[model samples]
Target: MVTPVRVVIALCLFVPFVAMLWVGSYAKTDPAFIGIPFFYWYQMAWVLISTALTMIAYQLWRRDQRGRSSRKGGVAE
Candidate 1:
């Protein structure tokens, strides 16, 4: 009963956690963006990315809950 949409939602939530956890991957500062060092800028950028991904996951979770509730003849909580 797991759907493709749910799989995509899980990926959206999982990817950012893995990316932020893998600090060594973006530890260098050679590639500065607009004068911001890679180390600082990279983490800052993920703050925004994480927020967006969380929002996406929330929306998708809501949709999935609605679907499940409808199938059970109950209102989504």
Candidate 2:
């Protein structure tokens, strides 16, 4: 049974991958941020965002595992 939490975690992982893959979307320089070009800053921002998303995914995964384990009487297998 797939849970909604798992779906949200999957989206968290998928969005960054898709965003980074679609390079042309942020390949411009007009929308500069803090003096950094769009191309450079966008990727850098995604780096931070990716780190956060990964942390969220890890925590969610751990919580899901714990839930499953408890449901099975805390058996480790």
Candidate 3:
């Protein structure tokens, strides 16, 4: 049941978790951005990035579901 599209969707969902959970990668106060410390700015940036990635994963999931439904002769996109 695994497809390339599903793999891509999994990647889209996994990246944000890996990025945020790996705190050492962003646990710094240097590289401040317009007064925002790296620690804070990095998290804020990931918030937006995570939102986008989640949206993409959701869309891909919908597409995958529709494909499966159609293959089963059910309602599809």
The numbered model that scores best in lDDT is: 3
- Write down the lDDT of every candidate, Cα atoms only: 0.92, 0.91, 0.93
TM-score of each: 0.87, 0.90, 0.91
Q: Per-residue CA lDDT of candidate 2, range 8-70, in tens? A: 899989999999999889989978888988999999999999999999998998888888999
lDDT of 1 by residue, 3-68 (tens): 988998989999998998998999899799999999999899999999999899889999899989
For model 3, how does the per-residue alpha-carbon lDDT over 1-77 read when each residue is reduced to its tens digit?
A: 78999899999989999999999999999999999999999999999999999999999999888879988998865
Evaluated with TM-score, which candidate comes out highest? 3
The superposed Cα distance between candidate 1 and the true structure at residue 42, in angstroms, equals 0.7
lDDT of 1 at 58: 89
Scanning candidate 3 in windows of ten residues, the lowest lDDT window is 68-77
Off by over 4 Å in 1: none
**CA displacement after TM-score superposition, residue 51 of candidate 1 (Å):** 0.6
